[model samples]
Target: MSRREFTQAIDFRHGRVDMTHGGGGRAMAHLIEALFVKHFDNALLREQNDGAAFALPPGTGRMVMATDSHVVSPLFFPGGDIGCLSVHGTVNDVAMAGGQPLYLAAAFIIEEGFPLADLERIVVSMARAAREAGVPIVTGDTKVVEQGKGDGVFITTTGIGVAAPGIELSGDRARPGDAILLSGSLGDHGVAIMSARENLALDSDLVSDTAALHRLTAAMLECAPGLRCLRDPTRGGLASVLNEFADQSECGMHLREEAIPVKPQVAAACEILGLDPLYVANEGKLVAICPPEDAERLLACMRAHPQGRDAAIIGEVTADPNHFVQMSTRFGGVRMVDWLTGEQLPRIC
Candidate 1:
């Protein structure tokens, strides 16, 4: 067939991906040009090069890179799909280092027989997410697997960013007397995924809080340049992040259970499932640790941002020979907030 005829022959609405789509031949090229390239059309991507190239600001300082893989069970979930989740997860990973995300690369592993219409929807969602985050998807690869051997789709995304000069953030930066600030409520993403999976009847509507947090991170950086540590509680949730800080910084964490925000719907869902909100995942929330003196200022700055409107100071760091994460109960008692032993919710991005 002629080039024009080949391009026009694709039945995007009714077609299904087959082995030829991954054969690196005409079929692959057609699929890419029609779908992936059509949606993620940045100048660098337009070049059709094996890799993306772009110059950084002259003095932008250290370059940061983060990679994430998304294999959520249901391709489409409440408020988000795997596409946006892949983009948002990688972007937030880069941002957690106090950096500005610049570019992204994506890879897709698709199963044979997957619907072209569904694939297009996912590509569009990814494109929208990258565009909204102001981070272009400059390069990508697509591969197809046998139908029964793979899930419908899996995505892996890599993000590159530049951290400003003199900005240092890591789990080990939590110092004694440092305040632990949580950006917004916890367990939204995890609960949303679980509710969608189990078809739970929640009192209030719930949606996954999947979002790119680089802008919120930027706002926090502007106000708290000396921020010690930042972490987006994802797979293992807020409790894991606190435990990580304690272990890395060799200090204890003291959290007030009442101060950590949990939405009504999410709380109720967790109660029904016998899950602790602390151990649930969150895609859009962040855990920040900064000097005690800068706690209020940082909280105010975070609250000013759309993504962090419910930011709160949930805890503080303490000097302890044995690192431990403890929580002050609402009933005037304290207990150790130990790490989660088993998976509460699986395959939640």
Candidate 2:
């Protein structure tokens, strides 16, 4: 029989893995076809090569690339884990530049004794995320370390995206007077993970906002095709990203406390943990800066989308040589939303 026919009939459902399963042999080929290919079965993947080859949508646009390493503590959480989070994280990084996420490559670093079932579950989650986002896991790599040398699992992801023509979006493009728009509530992702790990009691459905935002970003483009700047408030949260913009654009940002939305439970949890919600990370939200003329239309468009149901115009860019991010408190006071002094929380993303 031909090679294709031989692979087609491999038993996937009843397969018990061994070292040979990853040893580049018949077992490896069978494993790849039976598991990975079955889930990520797009035309490009059907070619069965080391890499996928495909064309971008018809447009003379710039290609965007982003990579991220996710070592979030617990592999599984309320809404997602490292698997789907890796996909959403990289996708948002590219989408923040007004790009549409097109493809992804994943690499897994697994400890020697990690459960095979857990690895399969993570792989399946990654596949599901890629398919749902209309992106493909075109290529991937896997490695195993000795029993005591590694964590349970770590995933690194790289994404390729396409940006529209004539669009110049960046941290340096946040001009004074530009309106700052937030896609939704803050700190959900970080809080959800923390609660899950600490086993803190909280209401159900308090899920991580881990999601792919390119589609919502596409909607933003539809309203304000000339979007000036965009960013995903991760790592150092909304505070750090805004400060980066302030430094890049040589501007200041004045945020209205009331305008920034945070779920009550997230706020309560932050208070209990002595953490600031503004400094906590979020996986699915985006902060966009655009001309005032486009703010109304952009926020309206954002609110109409499922990912952006809590969209709000949070702040405005200003001319401040110090490049500070200041805030007007809800209690009628002014203060500085300074750069993240030291790591307030680690392993946050």
Candidate 3:
């Protein structure tokens, strides 16, 4: 059939995806034009080429890249969905490197019989997130699998960014006496997902903390150019991030339990679920380590941002032969914050 004929023949309103959508035939083209393109209409994507082509301005600085896959069950959540999560995850990954994200590329795997309406909603959410972050989805690919072989949809997003000169952030950069900073409250995203998945009755205010962190990172960079390291505490929450820093820098981390921020609702939900907030997950929050002297200025800078209003100095790096992570309890005790043994919450991101 001709392109116009195919476009007119698609029943987007009542249709469900079949294997033909991934057959790379007319059906695929119709789906792309009607759904994906209609929502994510950007110049690079409008070219409809296999890949996006562009030139960077002179002195844009070192280029950074990051990629993430989103298989979170329940496509829709209280504060976000798989679509926004895919975008935020990769964008934050690049930003954690002290980079300003530039563009994004997405790939989708959709199960056969997935609803067109849900797919459209996901695509729209993705577009809005990329736009808000000032990053456009430049190119992408879509595939459909057998009904039972795949979940409703899985999205993988790849991000590209440019790091400013004199800005270097890595796990190994932390040194003894470096202050450990947390961007905000912990376990918000994890609690939100668990509550929604288990049908738990909780306060209506709970929602995923998924968000882009490039702006907040930029602000902190301005105040503390010597920022030692930056990491987003995502999959394993705060505990996992501290452990990673300890291992990478070959230094121990000492966290103050009272200093780490956790909302009352989130903490209560964790208690009912028999989960530790530190072992839970967060998307928007970050773990930053800076020189002790720079900590005050940096903390003030972070607090000035909307995303970092609840930022605090939760801990500090220490010299230790074993490179362990230990936290001081509020009751005047201390315990090890080891690496997550098993998957606490699978497919969370």
Lowest lDDT sum, 10 consecutive residues, model 2, at 1-10
Model 3: how far residue 165 lies from native, Å: 1.5
Greater-lDDT candidate between 1 and 2: 1
Per-residue lDDT, model 3, residue 48, is 85
**Candidate 3 regions with alpha-carbon error over 4 angstroms:** 1-9, 198-204
Candidate 2 versus the native: TM-score? 0.92
lDDT of 1 by residue, 174-248 (tens): 899999999999998888788777466554478899999999999998998989999999988899999999999
Q: After superposition, how far is residue 228 of candidate 2 from its true place, in Å?
A: 0.7
Score every model by TM-score.
0.97, 0.92, 0.97
lDDT of 3 by residue, 227-319 (tens): 989999999988998999999999999999999899998899888878899999998999999999999999999999999999999989999
- lDDT of residue 160 for candidate 3: 93
